[model samples]
Target chain A: MDQNYSTIGRSSRTKQAIEINKVLRNTYLLLAMTLLFSGLTASISMMMNMPPMTYLISVIGGMVIAMFVLPRFAHSTAGIGIVFLITGLLGFGLGPILSMYASVPNGSNIIMLSLGGTGVIFMGLSAYVLATRKDFSFLGGFLMVGFLLVLVAAVANIFLAIPAMSLMISAVVIMLMSGFILHDTSRIIHGGETNYILATIGLYMTIFNIFISLLQILGIMGGDD
Target chain B: MDWMKIVAALALIMFIVYLFPRARHMMENSPKGSSADWMGFVVPILVIVLFVMLLVQLV
Candidate 1:
């Protein structure tokens, strides 16, 4: 009976490992596709010089799709299409902001730097979690609390309007996003997150926020000159 | 003061305040991290911060 139990345990462990690997693979594959799709949409809109109204429409459309449509289809193949649509629309919305950054002196350099920084941070932290398989799930709660405090500071900053405070908020956001990269990736590799669509959304948002935050910081620093 | 900005900020604050309790609950229930776990988390974050600073400097 003990030998039978041991065999069963090993088999279950193997099965669980297989499931985790499958989820991780699907999540990364979907993530890469979504990122590229969004980049393409953003580039097209930026090159076309779309108006602010168009950006506003795309953002609202993306949010509406995300809030209402994605949940219903999250379990189906249609979920992938929804993910791409949401990302593509939001990417289109980014055109104006990217242009705003690009207009500043050395703005193009700042944008490229932020993009590179975002890539390095995402790839490094993701690799750390994927290689070590360390469960950073313990960070789930701390990260949530930190986000709240950061939100509070961000809201307060409107009244403050201090450049330093704004810089801090951007830096904190980048840090929070880095933490999320670990937490989200940890969930995928530890069986806490099973659905590839939801997993892709979580990581994509983290990367998006990191890129934006980096841009804000770089914009401020470079603009100061 | 832009009242519109104020209203938007207030709405955002309200939304986040609404999320606070759930975060609190999670904080109480989730597994606590040890020193090593925290170190594992912080070291990479440090690297990111430094790398970002270097990028800023280079530009």
Candidate 2:
């Protein structure tokens, strides 16, 4: 009976590992596709010299899709389309920012630097979580609270119009998003997150925020426009 | 009246206060992260720093 129990436990563990791996694989594949779609739309928006109003529209559209459409389709095959639409819209929003940055002195360099920094951070944090197999679920509450604080601060800073405060907000966002990457990736590894679409969205948002935050900081520090 | 700013400030302060207890709880329940985990965390920091350095050079 003891031997049978041990065998059962081992088998369950193996099955759990397999399930986690499958989810991770699917999440990554979908994430890559969504990111590409987003980039393509962003490039198009850039080429078209889209206005700031486009940014506002894209933000609202992406938020609506994420809040309503994505959740409704998260478990279905349609989730893929919804994910693409959300990411593509967000990417479209990036056009004005990218254009603004591109017009700055040495703007292209800053953009490239921000993009590289974002990629490095995402890959490094993700690899760390995967390699360590460390459960970062404990960070869930901390991240939620952190996010709330940051959001409030961000809104407040807009009226305050304090440069220093804006810089600090950007820095805090970088840390928060980095932590999220770890937490979200660990969730996939530990079977806490099973839906590939949801997982992709989580990771994508984290990456998006990180990139934007980095760009803001870099632009403020080095931009001449 | 600037009620919006006042309400936002109050909410922000309350949230900040709430973080203390939540942080304490988080610390107590934190997982045992290994060296590899630490390395992973540091990678992003280093990348950010490196890019900042690059940007500073341009300036």
Candidate 3:
């Protein structure tokens, strides 16, 4: 009787692990495709002279729809379709910055630097969480508060029109997003997030913020002829 | 910076964040059916398609 019970427990555990792995695999594949799509969309938008503001609004709209409506109604093959929709929207949203950078003489260099810098920060933060194995979930609340504060300051700065303030906001964004990456990654490893799509979205947003902020900083400091 | 676009993005992000917890709850309560499983691909594909279409039109 004991042996039979142990065997059943082991099987269940294996099943759970398999499910988790499947989710992870799908998340990674989707992430890769999203990145590729973003690149292609940005390139095309630049070629076509799409207005940056229009692209930005579309991205914002799509993000809201994806996060709210899609998740609610998407319970079938349609759910998968929603995922792609979100990814593509993100790509479109990214088009403006990509195009703007491309117009600069050294835009490509700046982009590569931003990408590399974002990658390094992500890997570093991820490594820290993995090595420590300590739950960083506690940081979530703090990060949210910090992010909001930054947002407010950013808005105020627009009216204030202070270059120094802009730089400070960018710095804060980089730090906060780095923290988010660490927290989100830790949540995944600790099984706090069993749904990998959600997990991927969270991580992707963190990385995006980091890259955008870093690019802004670079542009401010070294974007002259 | 266009304030309209910025505000729209901020509003959308806030709305999504507000909905996140509910979405998770729904996912948890729903039966693990194949239909639910298939929805996983829908969002990502839609994202790609919309982006591609937009890109083509823009280019």
Candidate 4:
């Protein structure tokens, strides 16, 4: 009887392991594709030389879709399409800012450096979580608080437009995004998150935030602005 | 100053309003973080900041 019980337990664990692995694989694959699609849209928008204010409109549009449309369709095949659409809109929004920077001295350098920094930070944090398998769910509250604080500061800076304050807010946002990456990845690995679309969204948004923050920091500190 | 800045600020305030309750609930329900967990978060972030500084310098 003990032997049979042990056999059942082993198989159950194996099944669960397979499920988690499947979710992880699918989330990563979709994430890569969405990133590539976003990049394509960004390139197209850049070539068109969009106005700077277009960023606000496109970003707001993307956010509205993400907040309202994504949850309803997350379980369906259409979720994948919606995710691509949201990412593409966001990328298109970014083109105006990239164009602004490209016109400045060493603006392209700042962009490349920001890209390199974002890639490194994302890869490093992800590898650490995958290797250690440490649960970061405890970071939930902290990350949220950080995000709210950053938002408040961001709103204030709209009036202030102080370069120093803007730089500080961007740095803090990058840190908050790192905390979120850990928390979100932990949820997926421990099976708190079962949907790959949602998981990809969590990761994609974090990466997006990190990339933007890095760009701001580089532009400010490098005097590329 | 500009219409874009005004719109941006309003959007940010809305986000803060939208996120506040969820964050409060998460704090109330989620597991309390220990000092070690905080350390785990801070150390990597510090490294990231340093790495970013290095990138700035190199460029």
Candidate 5:
């Protein structure tokens, strides 16, 4: 009787693990699709010749709305609303990329190069986390500090229009977003986040920021306007 | 190739990912399940199709 009960317990645990794995897999797949959609939207917007000033204003508005609304309402729609809002925000954020690409020669090539670089960094950092299985939760606070500093620098640079400051911000963003990928993935593996939608969104934001920053760096380095 | 098609496809992908887990769990727990039990198949296919279409458009 005890043996039968033990077998049942083990099977139940196995079933739970499988369910968690399914959630993780689904989240990664969805994240990939979101990135693709964001890319396509950006490309299309550029092709359509949207004004950069309007795009910048929309991005700012989107960020404000997302920050205020998402956390308050995320659980209401079983997280579906947050997912939709993220997708829309990402699409809108891609506007600057589209505008920059249109303004520069060899824009598509730069975009692709940036995409490839982002993929490489993501894969490398993710593999390091997975192989080591080290908890990076400690980095969370540090990452937040870095993010705030970058935000301040970015706002200041807007008025200064200093090229060196832009490069510094882009470099810092690349590093910060990489740290985020490590921290976010560790959360998923450790079961810190059970909801795959939330997990995917976190990971997707990290990837998006990394790609955008890398593209900016490339533009500054090699772009011919 | 057009923006509308891309947007529509993305929306469909979002819907599928949103629905798949519940659908899968429901099917697994249902007694009268048919060959349609493999509903999860649609999610990955939609993802792949959209991915391919995006790449093609990019090129």
Candidate 6:
């Protein structure tokens, strides 16, 4: 009886391990594809010399999908399609920012640096969580509070228009996004997150924020040249 | 140099400090891992910090 019980327990653990691995694999594969699609859209938008209004519209559209469509379709095949739409819209919005930077002195350098930095940070944080297998679920509440505070500060800064404050906000966001990468990856590994679509979204958002924050800082620092 | 930046930086620091203990406690109780694994994560952070510092210095 003891032997049978031990075998059953071992198999249960094995099944869980398989399930977790499957989710991680699917999430990563889908994330890579979405990123490529986003890049393609961003490039197309840049070539067309899209206006600011396009960015505004894309931002609103992406938010609508994120807030409404995503949650509803997250478990279906449509979830993957919606995810691509959100990424494409976001990428389209990014085109104007990239164009603005490219028009300035040393702008291309700043863009490259930001892109490289984002890639390194994302890979590093994700690998760390996977290597350590440490549960960072505890960070969820802290991150949420930090996010809300940052959002409020950002909106207020638009009216206040303090450059130094803006710099600080970007710095804070870079750190926050890095922490999110760690937290989200850990969640997937520890089984706290079971849905690949949701997992992909969390990781994608982290990358997006990190890239934007780094670009802001680097642009300011390099623009004078 | 404005008061806003100063205040914002201070607030951010305080929040991180307050949250540090909880994170440390969790890490402490986590499964044993090789030191190399920890370095895998820390190295990236150090690189990112250096990049940020370089940008700030240029400002």
lDDT of 3 by residue, A1-225 (tens): 999999999999888778766765666676676667766766666676778675667666676766676767554556656666676676677777777886787776767777776776677666666676656665555566667668667657756878878878987787778767766776676667777667666776777777787677766666331
Q: Ranking under lDDT, best-scoring first? A: 4, 1, 2, 6, 3, 5
Maximum-DockQ candidate: 4
In Å, residue B28's CA in model 4 sits off its true spot by 0.9
Candidate 6 lDDT (Cα, whole model)?
0.78
TM-score for each of the candidates: 0.90, 0.82, 0.74, 0.97, 0.70, 0.82
Which ten-residue region of model 1 chain A has the weakest summed lDDT? A52-61
TM-score of chain B as predicted in candidate 1: 0.79
TM-score: which is higher, 5 or 6?
A: 6
Question: In model 6, which runs have C-alpha deviations exceeding 4 angstroms?
Answer: B1-47, B54-59
DockQ of 3: 0.04
Kindly list the per-residue Cα lDDT of model 1 for residues A1-225, writing each as its tens digit: 999999999999999999989999999999999999989998998999987656556755775677678989999999999999989988888887888778778888888888888899999999999899899988989999999998888889878888999889989999999999999999888899999999998898888889888888888887632
What is candidate 5's lDDT per residue for A53-127, written digit by digit as tens?
A: 545544544454455566676565545656665666667658765577756786777678767767866777677
- Model 6, A112-154: lDDT tens digits are 8788778878887787788878766655555666676786677
Q: Per-residue alpha-carbon lDDT of model 2 for A1-225, expressed as tens digits?
A: 999999999999999999999999999999999888999999999999998667766866786678667888999999999999999999999999999998878889888988887887888788877888877776666676677778777767857878778788988888888888988998899898999999999899998988888788877787453
Off by over 4 Å in 3: A1-10, A73-75, A127-132, A223-225, B1-59
DockQ of each: 0.60, 0.18, 0.04, 0.80, 0.02, 0.10
Instruction: Please give, for residues A1-225, the per-residue lDDT of candidate 4 as tens digits.
Output: 999999999999999889999998999999999999988999899999988887898888888888889999999999999999999999999998888888898999988988888889988998888898888999898889879988998999999989999889988988899889889888888988999999998899999999999998888888767
- In angstroms, give how far residue A137 of model 6 lies from its true place: 0.7
In model 1, what is the error at residue B45, expressed in angstroms? 1.4
Q: Which residue pairs overlap in candidate 6's backbone?
A: none
Return the interface RMSD of model 4: 1.0
What is the clash count of model 6?
0
For candidate 2, the clash count comes to: 0
